[model samples]
Target: MLLEGSTANAVGSQTLDLHRTCTKASQIFSSPGENFIQNKDTVKYGELIVLGYNGSLANGDKGRRRSRLALTKRLKANGVKPDVIHHISTPLVSKALSNKGHHSISYTLSRSHSVIVEYTHDASTDMFQIGRSTESMIDFVVTDTAPSGGGSGGSAQSTISRYACRVICQRSPPYTARIYAAGFDSSRNIFLGERAAKWRTPDGLMDGLTTNGVLVMHPTGGFSEDSSPGVWREISVCGNVYALRESRSAQQRGKLVENETNVLQDGSLIDLCGATLLWRTTEGLRRTPTLKQLEALRQEINAARPQCPVGFNTLAFPSLAQREVVEKKQPWVYSNCGHVHGYHDWGFRKEKGGVERECPMCRRVGPYVPLWLGCEAGLYLDAGRPTHAFCPCGHVCSERTVRYWSQILLPHGTHAFHAACPFCGTWLTGGHEQIKLIFQGPVD
Candidate 1:
């Protein structure tokens, strides 16, 4: 899809800046008893948290560019629904309709003929867009995330679309939220060219897909301790579910998944080619652990007084605030054997591809890396003890959390897919992506 025109004057007399309006709305609908009196009546749909960030971005959350964004009821509805369809033979008419400032989608069949679907305001729902674009229309701006919490600007060449996808949430009870493949650009228009994957449905309705496509996977159960990963399906511009394409950018669309729909559930994973997001419903979040609980867990682990078998030095996981810096006393794991020890200079083993270390206790040679506690509380499947760690990048989390993420495969680059550590975005290596920690107590 191609995006054209400048959005600077797109709104004409009215405000074209929904970004400012959304920021204000989120503030006004803040937690109860803070500032706004109507907070008691405010309804929160859910939250979209980008994978790989421990909590906030490396540079910190700024404006709409953040690790997580709360989808709440807007002061005024900004959603639009298809109201009128025009088959115009003239390019002048199509341009005029798009310039009207209202949201629209143009499907160019050929040079002489095209279809323009005009959208009217829908007061019952609110819309939020997610993409790599820094434009005002994108409610949540996301870029590719690198492993080890390097940050969103990790990739120089990103596959994420400028206007990747949009989500619409119903205003009333149930607060059903649905995701679509494409988003309206700065000029509030989505254009599907002739070569784009599009077709008419049996009922004679126009539907299409974005370039790389937007894929979603809902947990088999809900987002909980027992939850398991679901099948990954592609969502269309008209909110239809289908199987994944042969390749990421294949022109052919996949088979329609009649049993599945675009409605989002807790623990739903949305992959935008270059980046992936985890959707946590308000109800699901209530059941998950809070930051205070996670802090207490960290303190509990430190209180255990685990020591290195070789160095006999006490090791502690750093606080959540100290994200990037590795502490000398931090626990280092021999990921191959699940042995935990304090950081030491010895145990170096010669390897061909990368650094390798031989474990003093188990005599197993493998990647020895520092263990960092997964700070993002929302990613935790349960408040269970943080007993397991992900291989390669040893980010420790709850047993279920590590296991769940390790079993699921995410889109990498274009054609390749692999299971990655949700906390650090590192591709899991070897057969066992997750290993049980064997922490040693103080040798007295």
Candidate 2:
């Protein structure tokens, strides 16, 4: 959240407008040639730059202009802009180092109700005139539990609430390969940005600069570094969206072996501006439709004529004007017990196999395994649901399992899996279930 290199000058000005205009999952445009700075990376040839902030804006994010002006005036008074300036507040500079640019945020809001009796606030007799507000926000999460014998029939009633949320940013294509200096995702199927750099130290490059710089890296290509001679590893993926790097070290090593002319004296040195990087993309994959070919295919799909054969197609045709691109349809993967895998939109559940997901537990007859969503919470968190997975030892345990049991068994969202491996297996003990949105469709 810290920044270096420049002070924001127009704090309360067009910054709000910029924020309002900027949206999630859209690219910020810039013109050519200007040094369009983003994150810690300095990008030249940028005419305009979009700004983003990922996390929530705590009150600490806002600042008054007095502090900025004081530092700038001090720098000017001292005969020059200081190597660095303390926190400067301005929109232009803020846009340059936007939090949204590097990360994103998601939150859920819901409402529930609780009741309590409060004495009325009346100054006439020294009583207070306060009434309890029955409604407020509450968490929607529930864990399975055994129903204890009802104490009093009149237990105060409460409401369960629900809310919407998202966890990942819409990734853009063609990320530069250099951006992957940090690392890549293994299973989450997402990318992470690098952490901010320390600034203004004795060895720091921002010595007198007040504002901070941008940080960027890209990921692509094979996981190998050896490239053949004359073959560069720098390549772009489809749409030329992401830049990738590969290894030419092997080829580079080979070139060293081949005879070559070197006209440099023993003490000579050479300085180079930059070098071109060579790379291969998906276009080179086995017989993928080429760019030109795909275009032609689309045309054919639209303009082809029907043959004189009987055909009954009851397909749901969509209007070209209001088309929404969803991932291509695929069959929903499910367990024999009825746990549904993700699909495009609506989720289908069977009364038997569609049991809500829950955590691992042990039953007298078998092991308590997840059969549906909230399964983890069902057995372990005391979610009053079915006692699915069982133990081989012939025991059916329906008592509410505890959190420690979950930490010793399941890996959260992986509730659809058996509590214990069928064959020789290792248990994935760690963390409680993390709620995720899942969709499933009926079989065609």
Candidate 3:
């Protein structure tokens, strides 16, 4: 069965407050007239942030190709719903109908017989498309995220579909959003060839899955420090949920999960095979640390004057903008024992791989790497002080943030899943995914 719409009532006065907050935030990026006229009147559904990016893209966020996208109610809704179904025997008729400038999904049952489901515009909801496509129909253009030190060059082939998925959000209060498998192309159509996984539902409606499929994992609890990872499921073209296929590109579909729906939650994780996205509702964002709060936390840590035991030099986390370049007073860590120190070339244990270094303080030998503050505020579960760090790749954040990400098993490739650092797409290593850093204060 298809997913049902949310029956929750309007958020009442919180809606006005949310509108005001969204308006205030939009003003920073938009002109005064545009901010007041275009933004203030609109309702913000939520935001979709791609994992791995610290804050912005490598070249910086440009147009729709940014690291994050805000799904706001458009002036005119452009969402589409399945309207008419046609079974055409002629190839020309199928081709002609798809090119008619209307949204559609074409399922090729065979060479001669094909089922085409036409869609009509939905005035009550706004639609946003995401994919690797550069087409105008896609609101957010995402590319494959390469793991740090993996040496997977930018020229590497991407597994992400050109038109991967689409999100339709209700325009009314309590703006519920639902995600579907494939997105409409520039011609306003989604075509599932015979080789693709297409089937007829019990209601006699046609449904299909994309080549790589669109997978979603909603957090068991709300998007908070206490939240746990939920079961990952595949979403069909009609927004029905199902268990994961045996393989990503398998011809057969998994069993239907009647209880679960395609309705997105605050901490929903959308994996598009190549890249993963984190969904944060406006209410959830309020609980997370803002950029200003993160900067304050950085200042608070630096104020304590954390010192290196060996070098006797005070170490400080570099500004978020200067994170790439290792600062002279930057703090380094022995990932195994969590001893914070200043950069040193010595203590490299040649016996246990040159990358492993013996910590001078604790005598624990482990992977030694520089500590980088996690800058993406949206990824944080709370505004707690930055304390713990992820192992292997030392991206530091709140204890809750580190704990949350360390427990998440993000989809790595087609079939495998692994825990990765959200700030950098580095796979977590060691017995424990994170460590509580022991920072030495100024001895003076």
Which run of 10 residues does model 2 get worst, by summed lDDT? 65-74
Instruction: Give the alpha-carbon lDDT of every model.
Output: 0.81, 0.17, 0.81
Give candidates' CA RMSD values in order.
7.4, 25.7, 9.9
The TM-score measured for candidate 3 stands at: 0.90
Cα lDDT tens digits for candidate 1, 148-195:
667557445788888888888888889999988888876778899988
Give all TM-scores, in the order shown.
Answer: 0.90, 0.18, 0.90
- Give the distance in Å from residue 115's predicted Cα in candidate 3 to where it truly belongs: 0.3
Give the distance in Å from residue 410's predicted Cα in candidate 2 to where it truly belongs. 23
Report the CA-based lDDT of candidate 3 relative to the real structure.
0.81
lDDT score, candidate 1, position 312: 88
